[model samples]
Target: MSDWGVDRGVRVLKGVRHFRHRIRRKMDIMFDAYLNSEGDFPMCDSPVWIFGRSYSVNYDLDELRRSVASCMWVTYRKNFGSVGETSLTSDKGWGCMIRTGQMFMAKALILRHLGIDWHWEPDSRDPSYLKIVSLFADLNSAPFSLHQIAQTGSTLGKPVGTWLGPNTVCQAFKKLLSSGATGLDLTMHIAMDSTLVQSEVKRLCLSHPSINPFASATIPSSSIINTPRIDPKWRPLLLIVPLRLGLSDLNEAYVPGIKAVFEIPQSIGIIGGRPNHALYFIGYAENEVLYLDPHTVQPTVHVGSKLDESEKAADETYHSQKPGRMSFLAMDPSIALCFYCKSEADFDSLCRKLTDRFSVIPLPLFEICERRPQDWTTSDPIFMSSPRSNSSGGRNSPGGFTSIGLPGSSSSNSKTRMGSSSSSTFSGDVDDEEFEILG
Candidate 1:
């Protein structure tokens, strides 16, 4: 062979070797995922609680797996369009928190359209399920896509391709839902300063007049009628409560409260994880918290309005068959709890459950008040502004959590009344002060 021929052969050999390496790496990932799906879960003989429903390990193991598999799993994706003006096309490294927020909001949509007991089948073509999944596609058109979340974060002082904390992601979702980008008839209310004001949530939920709070186009009218209508004045509510359970690690005192929230029917899930990494926590088994991890990087899949055969296959990427688990004690101190109330009765039931569960505990996760304290004020420009208002504010620390307290109160009592004082201004920055839970 001539010298040119020899050089061509060498280049061809290198290309073949590169192809083999790529194939091997892909197979290894598949093998790892298969192993994880087959046998990574811990043996929890205790009853498993997932989003208010319990399953028996011995008898309902299959049911438990199915219940978990039904949740929409949003994760890191690559090869999508650039987010905003940045060249970043993938959210692999810095988008975990945003993905967790997507998972949380996706669950709310599922509960709203498919009901609590809705099960997902591999080949099932449920219109509502497909619709819900499409909304989170990586494309820019999807309302809750990574592209939208990242761009929205930019408005809140979070630049594209940067890490976001649980509070910032929750705020992003609130802004997205309020912008009317999502056609779903639901409202998001973020309880700032670790305080959940009943009157505020009531006003937020009831202000919008919905003909049928439980109605969905995919659901038949008969099914809608069967769903009990507690009150016509109420609109569906997505209540996001951002809390700093502890300064660094999750406070052991708040463990029981966190577990109890998962058992409430109104509970959607939680968007939190260990420091830096983010996870979508759905349920708990004994001391372990069950979560859907977003660390896996997958190729971008486009889900359109119509669910064709190819689209159905692509949609499978959005659902995970296996759930990740870790000790609740291992969770980071910064976290956001999500809940969905479809009616007035549901909201009332949530308040009752919260009061019953947290009232007796010495250190409650957060306080529930009928209304904002008489002396309390709402001066957080970022949070208090209209949904579409483009207001700038200080960016929250990527891993640090935010906490609010009564202004000028130097008391360190755990049970002190951290009323909403008008003199106090809310900041995204973290503080050493503790939140007071209103009885």
Candidate 2:
């Protein structure tokens, strides 16, 4: 044989060896994950709360494990298609915040479709549950996939493969939901400036005439046909309140209020973690926060269009049997509190809880008011009517909706809020001057 041909054959053998090595390394990681235990839950007597429902460590430990395991655990995934135009195929290092955001949103979806009481079983093949899982699959078409979130973040000035802050993730999800990416008929309202205006949320939730409440009752999938049913009543709401509890560390005073958040029935969870790390904070037991960590890296798996054994096996990676805990004081102050209100009554109850419970605290994490403060300067409008606006150009536009960026246009008084030692620092971007001073 020619010398050149022999050299080409040698290169081919080396390439095959490299591929085999990669497969073995991936298998070893998977094996380690299977054997690794996430540590037992705290045996302390403090009542365990997982997304509003409370459980006792002594008796309800089994139920607690089920609840924690049922939560959709999104983590770093590899071998998926490149994110946007970037060549990076894995989010092992920079996608924790995005993964946490996906987890938080997935909880909201669970409440929306499967109901808060729905439980996950290993052999269960409920269509609604499967549909939710598919929406977050690593595929590009998945509405809440990492690819989509990273792409949306890029539009919000966040480059792909970069770590996203809590506020940035919330904003990105809000935009994605507004684009009708998730056909769940839910409205996402991000309470900016640490103030959740009751009127604004009601308007956003109740003003949508195009969304059919009946049609959204069931999960949307390829097999179903939407008849354009319209219900101007109350649409399900995903409320996200981005807060900064302290300048550098979480303030001890706000810890009580944070704990109280889990007691509220509408609570989804909080998206925050230690500096440089992100976690999905689902509940709390006394001083420690119970969370689902997204630090583990797993090879991406696709959930097929149908719920079969292969799809079910692939989804097993989306859940964790063990729940991780962290002390409240160890958390980063910059966080986003998530809630899902399925009905008008739920929203009312949430507001009442905020007013009655959170207000009593010395320093409330946030405030709820019936209307925007009169003295505060008016900011940009939250929603704008599309070209299909109704003849009545009033607040309730039956046509459709589109959302702009943050409410305010200028950052003149942003520093004043952060400069004060007692006040919580707030910023829209991670390392930028665009701060929204909470009232």
Candidate 3:
């Protein structure tokens, strides 16, 4: 008999049916509990309707990392690791570990929820193996490392590997909901940003309908739809830009929108110093949740929570005395991260001259290397092999491999294509989307 026939034939007897029914009922109860619990989370005073989109992997950790990173490596580097930290040679290793692991698990969880097939794996990269090496090192150096636990299945002995962080594991929970189900979307918005200095945020729906990165991939290896996601229909982000005519600090501009004084962290500083008042920002939509900025905002919170009841706590800290940070913007400082600046003086000057003093600078954006004709022939080199660069040229991105020039090459090839090939990359924020900045 076939495997299914043998396994289920007698298994479907009276007792089996009763057990299955019990299991089904238990599952229903569990699902209802989760749905009901979602209500306990906070919501905006005036909620709005918005949609979301995403495109993620559905296979081995390495596979997803390789696939996603292969296209926009600069993004991986920017996101996964520290940036412009000249004090330290920023290695992309940690970033790779965190980002790839997160993507892999997120994809897997989504697929599992969708009842699709997807795989996950441990880190096989060399540096990743260093933790294992540490286990061996500890064995040679410390008594605890040498200690062994006796188990029924033990043959002789076991050298459990020193494991690296489960950036991957953490992502799995974030994607699946410790409770149940896994669904994601790059998230679109018809939202508001009233916290001050914040622009109205919206989703950039560039992924193809089939390339919902938030949604898990149904296939493993490359498929016909393997290219970066794109769509013809444009849904311009509802550009509710405040300061319709002025300039402000990028940090204060896009603070992730956070509500409720209760969810605020208990401490905002350390013993003898200020506790961190800033938090990784997330948002709510029609009762759904959205992950906004995670880091970069702590560039120094320097904000006063008007609703904070901890006046004694505030007086106890030296750091809280700093200038007030614009709080109304979405909480993420990175959201305000733009190279553009038009200082108060510049704006005042412009106002005096009856002109707009917006010294525009491009915000950080994902880069994609569009395969275009290489005009320069020189295999030149720039400062020890052209400074490391993002291949997907964004308006503000540095030159990539092209930055390197033969000993005798023109300056033309050195110019990086920082912008996308298409003017319509963003269906929503198009007309005013020229990567502008003002001080």
Candidate 4:
């Protein structure tokens, strides 16, 4: 007897009809499902909408470390033998390790949420990796020997990889947005001296030259978007920035707007003595603020040496993992740095939401980036003075939001003077003090 005939004769006791066809169709569906899975399936990433553009947010840990060369490698050990194999060096690059993992994760989250394209592994020609890498290192492509610098009496010179400061990160972010990668036209209104901002990017590129860092890429070039001023059209992503702020102001000034309509997330860099540690503030529960810790190594789950299973497992692990959280006491020195948006009328709506929630005006944002312990007393001006015209003074910002025109628009060639001093050391009025200067 045929297989179906034999099965039917033995299993005909049930009242179900079309059982054979139903079983075959179900099997077909399962087969299709298996074939359409990640890694093995080779489909585009899942789409996430941002600024009216659809971007793929589905990415893995390996894509996170591409920009920093030294931190790209991961070591593995074999259970059965003494030796283990190291695969692709794409795992999340742990630069500052316990210190700055949060910053890396925060940047990764920002980039992911914004839907900007990131690492295209083993593809040297792609610019996305270069852009992200610039955020980590100077990217001049210098020789390895020059990358390390020794301190007084230090036998081994410390490896000076291309980890950027908070200011540099802000500058690099503006650069990326202006590069046409982000569909929205954005401008960064920095409160610090413009000359310092210009010089910082130049210094990074001089040390590391292989990456061929663009000079214009250093600053967001304060420019206005001339796109069709209508719905679904490009408008300025105005970034109102501050150099630093105390913990109280961190919660009072930045936190409310953060909790309100706009989604400009703040990253806490330079906590107490740890300059490398960067924590992205997610939200607050009572007096405590929750954040994501990227210091712990996220492993790539594998099984039986099968490519399909390993890929599937890694993807599953990424989705299931949750960001770690912490309380307010965890923040030493009680200082944090961040940015607030002040773009179009929609931003006014966001401000309105903040007012309704907290009954406070959203201007004059008090933000801070902690200082390196040694340089804490250096008194460079924290508050920006009258900047050039394109960058203006108005009620919109702590300093004010000035529209820097298009990419090629005239910028002041004259450099603004910068102090060797640091913002952490402030003798200003205690009432006016935005940052908790831990003397």
TM of each candidate vs. truth:
0.78, 0.77, 0.20, 0.36
| Predicted structure 3: lDDT | 0.22
lDDT of 3 by residue, 1-439 (tens): 8999977877778678898986785565445434533222222344421111121222232432332221101102121112222222222222222222222222322221221222212222222122222221111221111111111001111112211122111222222221111222222221111111112121133322443343344422211112221222322111111111111122221112222211121101100000112211122333232221111111111113212434323212211111111123212111211010112232123222211112222321111111223442322111122222323332111111123232354333222122333322221021121112210
lDDT of 1 by residue, 18-125 (tens): 999967855654454344433224676887888998877778878888888888888888999888899998988899888888888888888877888888887887
- Looking at candidate 2, the ten consecutive residues that score lowest on lDDT are 395-404
Of the pair 2 and 3, which is ahead by TM-score? 2
* Candidate 4 C-alpha lDDT tens digits along 188-237: 34334211232222232234223212334434432111232222322323
Best-to-worst ranking by lDDT: 2, 1, 4, 3
lDDT of 1: 0.71
Instruction: Give me the displacement of residue 384 in model 2, in angstroms.
Output: 11
Q: How accurate is candidate 4 locally (lDDT)?
A: 0.30
lDDT of 1 at 133: 79
Error in Å for residue 114 of model 3: 5.9
> Alpha-carbon error at 338 in model 2, in Å?
0.3
Segments in model 2 whose C-alpha atoms lie over 4 Å from true places: 1-38, 210-232, 305-309, 378-430, 433-439
Better of 1 and 4 by lDDT: 1
Q: Candidate 1 clashing pairs?
A: 376-420, 376-421, 377-421
